[model samples]
Target: MSRLFLALFLFLLIREKYGYTNITLTVNYEKILAEVRKEFLSVSLDTHLIQLNWGGLNFENQRVQRYARNLAPAILRVGGTSADSLYFKPAFGKELASKNILPCYDPCNCDMDYKTVETFNMTARQWHQLANFAQRVGWTLLFDLNVLDRHNGSWTGKNAELLFDYASRKSVGPVYWQLGNEPNILPHFYNRSINPSTLGRDFLKLSTIVKKYKAFQQSLIVGPDVTHPKQDMNSSKPMKYLRAFLQAGGEALDAVSWHHYYFDGRQATADDFVNITHFDSFKEQAKLVCSETRRILGQKKSVWLTETSDGYGGGVRNLSQTFIANFLWLDKLGVSAQQGIELIVRQSFYHGCYGLLNPNLEPTPVYWLSVLHKRLVGTQVFNVSHNSGSKIRFYSHCGNRKSSLVVFGMNLNNFSVGVNFGKELAKVKFRVFIWTEDLVIKGFKDIQNKFVKDISFEMPPKSIAFVKFRKLVGVQACK
Candidate 1:
């Protein structure tokens, strides 16, 4: 009896030492649920789109440009809170006019020169330079125009006319025009609210102005770029504002646009950065927007999440810039695509705390995640399922170019978990990319030769992996 007891203890210890909880993932490639658009993994460029100099050149540092080029087929939106206050000067030596500017907002105010209206101005020459830069980087510009002209109760088109004229003269690339930024929250800053009817009329007038120039006529007009509608007491205003805007001007819009942030920057922590539940709120917001747009327009129009990130106020210090943020970033992309969102423009490319690149234009973990997403995930989404519960989330997509299927999995557990691809893909070798806590990307590698019917691999705690099956069976979508 003593010998048997000792043997049992040794067996249990060995099992605990090298054991891994098995997880099986079943993917149905035949179900063609949705098509992820080519411009799915795009980003936004805020009002501080470029660093301008006195010589009127809009420039990006070489490092910034190099990092940006990796994430191509991207959409760059040049608008934010600063956009509403931007003063566009078409020519050099223009005298500073008092009426041309307004008080810059929170983030912009910190660096603004209060004495001159030129503090947040962008010259026409700078605009041309920006256009050239966009062309070189394979990005399409979604430029915003100032609409807070107090001289008229509605939007003013003077600066827009100048921009369009300059673009036409220089033969700049196509620019999607967004009239204003977050009109719903304008009341909080400007202490004035332009009602839906007034805004619709303004959009009509702006549309007319855009048509005057051949270059502008070819561009899309998307607007009422409102803030996310909240569920609490403060929600009524933005919700009502959107309903009214859609009712009045839904016909004029080529696409409906809005913004979202998972948490408030001031209160966010590292734990909050990896919390998967935070992503549910974003999906709910997308559903609300989709439902509202369909009801107002009598059909579903293309919806664009023009600006978004983990936290709103420039993001939390260590959380947004670290490897933890990749969980939120990649999950957001997967959820946004599943929710039928046409395009999701990440809040920033190279500005603010939530930016993919830091102030020095160095790539952050999120930037590396974006690069991998662009390379692995394609425009077609496949149905993926796992019984391992919420701690392990799985998303699959058709490969971008090869006859392959890409599966992205996030392991939020502290201990290592094993993922089995099942008998169908068991014999197939996978190209795996793992994003770890140290922000190091373990490039693609094949599993060992021993596993023929299943591949059992250990996933580190709080990490994400991208696995590509070189030739997945019955995935007609990739063909």
Candidate 2:
């Protein structure tokens, strides 16, 4: 079947089999004197802030900058597929000889060296420029190192130390240092010969070299930032590498970072745009990995969803570029909230599939949603529940400036529900946020970009919604 068919089939199967709710309701104040507590985690953008370790040309975008500034407490994951290009591959043929000296290392063909002082000078200048950029934005930096540098153990501790010192000296300290960008899976895609155990050893070596620099003391070392595991460890998977890291007593690193993408690579759904379970699944996986890593490390180090997106590659060509991104990108924030995770950054704010803005920097529908979550949600509170597995998840939040209710309405059974808050919820006012999908057939983008007019709605089957709340002007009895 086509990817689209698979998506539809998956949604149907989920609704028919694993869906949790059968009812949903809309409510007004004075009906439920429910006490909601403020429970928002810190917000940050996973800045792509793409870098060039090669000829030292950085493609910095002002739109991305504006996005980051608008979303403060941003985290910039500074590597991508381009991360592999330590230097541009040069051509020896007479046809096109203007090849830049490529950065050759193990498992990669980065064998060329600098032929001119200009290239070396350019690299140094770029690092400084990137450092300045991070400090200006107050970015929580995540430096994904070039692991291929040590491919055949070519990049010894001495060699790795040079790069680390260069970064520490030129750039502001990296808040988190991921060993490599999903190395476990790179072997299959890049034709790399490295295995999980080798990946682990290299990580250790990289960590050691990075620590030699004095500045690394202030920065945290996080590692194995493995790509999403295949269902059955089909390729150079991370599970074994991680298992080996623990067996080796991985005390050199401080945290474990991992990536996740929820949708089937082959498909997209009309309601797929509206699914929040993807966020839940990604967060859950990160949570599980974090739990397992902590168990292995025998310490309470944090786990970071350092890199994640909706589609596998550049993402499916669909409404993901539109409003569905709110649900798609909400994983960055909602997952953090769900797991009490310390930090989670989107894979790339502007890469092909995961980017929040277009090449022109037009905000995707998800960007606005991210803004709402960052600005509107609270920072600390207890668990918010509204009956187990009901289509609507109600959260009551109270804080210095506001008290609110957030209802996550999910519909799958083609059913409606009348929900009454318990006596504990009567005093709150309702100000809902809507998240229903544009009703479409399973395969079409029929209503992908559209949503309900308001939070008040009869949630359609196979749809999702988020309704928020606030107390009325004169309800001070709780004081």
Candidate 3:
């Protein structure tokens, strides 16, 4: 049988396999809460990966290209902690070294003794390969520039200018730029700190450099990509740092960016993935970031969650790679869109345990969810409210199709919760997507897809579902 037929067969096979209940909830789609960019869903490539020879990406592999294309028109961000130390070489040869800095072989092994600067190098050939791969896959490139390459506590921009000149000469045009990665925590990693004022100055200098190159003239400059904005002992308060950065370099920036992670991989548990409180924490952080951006930079600049994932420290092995992690991943997309974030870049698209695809290019559950989201969810966000309590999250967005809306959510409760989309959607057809508990092992074989005519249905506990309301009469926002 064909693949489509097989998918359809499996979808039908599990239609009535799970039980149902009468937990009716409501959806309010009259207002558009926020709108996101057409290219809202994006992925990030860790610099360590490129330093580690593509980190097993194998862009030459058809499967790799195919999987990547599934989420096309995305922003492929080449950044991470290693971005601060990576430099572009003019040619392919022995890697350059400076400040007694050794070329980074292992991206994860960080030296706690930060008396001297550590560095990594990539050749011009590798740079072109990266651009070629992104072009082939129809992704926009967002390159993060090195911030630690400074002289007299000021950004030199010499290395960045060389890279720009190379990209321009090589005909790689129109890549987005970020000056640094988490400058608030710089003191911890490099035993150095670029105060927000200095960071702002650095960004301004980077902007001037960007404008000099014809190829990078129109590129969007986004930064100061800091961590979550909260008071913490380990790093500068991101909120205060962000405010200072914007005050100093707001004129140079086109957008605001930040990173977020729900749990520390070293200390996270499987149960944390499904915790409603953790999801709420992300919602709160997103709100604060959005509000801060608007307060400082005004309403014109967009906010981006440039780097985010479930577990920050290389991700928790089995938990991050398994089916349970979708709870946090799916909710993040929902909350970010609702809170007016224009783009979200998932970190290490193919590097660590949190990768959407493993090194061999085999997809994790979240990869499939991302595919579904890109294919089904549209840029128009609708204001959706429900009385389903904390365990159930409901978000509505204009469907990819005209006059259609897709309402998606995950049931955190161990028992099924019935949902009612209200009388407004009483006659619409529902397409339910719920996978079996063995999703990580069986892949799509465990996915259940069926069209239901009923206005209400029960979603199995700990399961995520996407219901597309087709044949809708009126949803002004969708149109």
* Separate clash counts for every candidate: 0, 32, 2
User: lDDT by residue for model 1 over 1-479, one digit each (tens)?
Assistant: 99999999887677568653568778777776567568788887767443233112125656556666778888888888767777677785443323434322232122433224333567776676677778778888888888775465867687777777767887557788888788887765555677877887788787788878776777888887888744333733666788888888777888888888887776788888767588667777788887788778765577788889888767777767778888888888887776677788887786667878666557777887788888778877766787776778788888887778988978987766778776476656776666678645422122122113225466777878888777655677787
Cα distance off (Å), candidate 1, residue 290: 2.0
Query: TM-score of model 2 relative to the true fold?
Result: 0.68
Cα RMSD of all models vs. native, in order, equals 4.9, 10.7, 6.9
The Cα error of candidate 3 at residue 338, in Å, is 0.6
Model 1 / residue 430 / CA error / Å:
1.6
Ranked candidates, highest TM-score first: 3, 1, 2
Residue 479, candidate 1: alpha-carbon lDDT: 79
Q: How would you encode candidate 2's per-residue C-alpha lDDT over 356-436 as one tens digit per residue?
A: 655455666555555555555454423444544532444332323454545443443444433444444444444434444
lDDT of each: 0.72, 0.50, 0.80
Top lDDT prediction, candidate number? 3
> Model 3: per-residue lDDT, tens digit, 281-323?
9999899989988998898789999999988867877777678
TM-score pick, better of 1 and 3 = 3
The Cα error of candidate 1 at residue 70, in Å, is 0.8
